[model samples]
Target: MSRQEFLVDIVIALPSDLPPERRAELVAAESARARELRAAGSIQRIWRRPGQTANVGVWVAESATELHDLISSLPLFPWMSVRVGALARHPLEDDHQ
Candidate 1:
């Protein structure tokens, strides 16, 4: 089976009013999903930045469409906005290609 990889950058705003335990629960739930995907060989790598408000998950899938679908299915916070983009190309102001 052929697998495609993508760098997924997720940005979310942490709720200031939420308790520490609740925040931990939310992280646990997200980690559970990561485990599920990893077990299925769908996730290649996952990384969380410290003192940052975003998550970066590198995923391996069969196609770009599948990746989009996966991101759409995530249970994100109600006030959060997600931005999914293909990460193959470099984002630069100069045309180096």
Candidate 2:
């Protein structure tokens, strides 16, 4: 099946009582996994909201189920509050070439 696009907004809220070292470890692993997804084309674009623990990204997957699986693969998924929207091709973006 052809891939579909999804827009994702995520806020990572680790408990304030969580140990700093554990937070660091999860962050490190999350970064590595995100890189892998990007290389694999699952992550199309990503941006961080400055001065916040949040990010927005465009992702590609075969289906919403696939998208969920991909996002859940992140090491910090359990600590994330996320929103995802399916994206549709813009009429102005038609490729006739």
Candidate 3:
């Protein structure tokens, strides 16, 4: 099946009282997983929001269910507030895959 494009926005809000060591561990794990996804083409692009623990990415998957699974696989999933939106090509734009 062909993949679909999705705009993903994520904000990670860790508990204030959580141990610093555990926070670092979680962040490192999330970074590693994100790298793997990028290498596999699931993450087309990602941009971090300045002054905030947030990011937006262009992602791809065969279906919304699959996309959800992929996002949920992140180590920081439990601490993240995420929003996903499907994307479609604009009529006036050059062909985009």
| TM-score between model 3 and native | 0.94
- Order of the predicted models by TM-score, top scorer first: 3, 2, 1
Provide the lowest-lDDT 10-residue window in model 3: 88-97
How displaced is residue 2 in candidate 3, in Å? 0.7
How well is each residue in 18-96 modelled by candidate 3, as lDDT tens digits?
A: 9999998998999999999999999999999999999999999999999999999999999999999999989767765
User: Candidate 3 at 95: error in angstroms?
Assistant: 7.4
Query: Between the candidate structures 2 and 3, which one is better when assessed by TM-score?
Result: 3
Candidate 1 residue-wise lDDT, 1-97, digit = tens: 6667787777777679989998888778776776777788776777777887777777877788887677655555453555555546457735765
| TM-score versus the correct structure, for each prediction | 0.61, 0.93, 0.94
Compared with the true structure, all predictions reach lDDT values of 0.70, 0.95, 0.96
Pairs with backbone N, CA or C atoms under 3 Å apart (clashes), candidate 2: none
Query: Mind sharing the TM-score for model 1?
Result: 0.61
Error of 3 at 10 (Å): 0.4
Candidate 3, residue 3: Cα displacement in angstroms equals 0.3
lDDT of candidate 3? 0.96
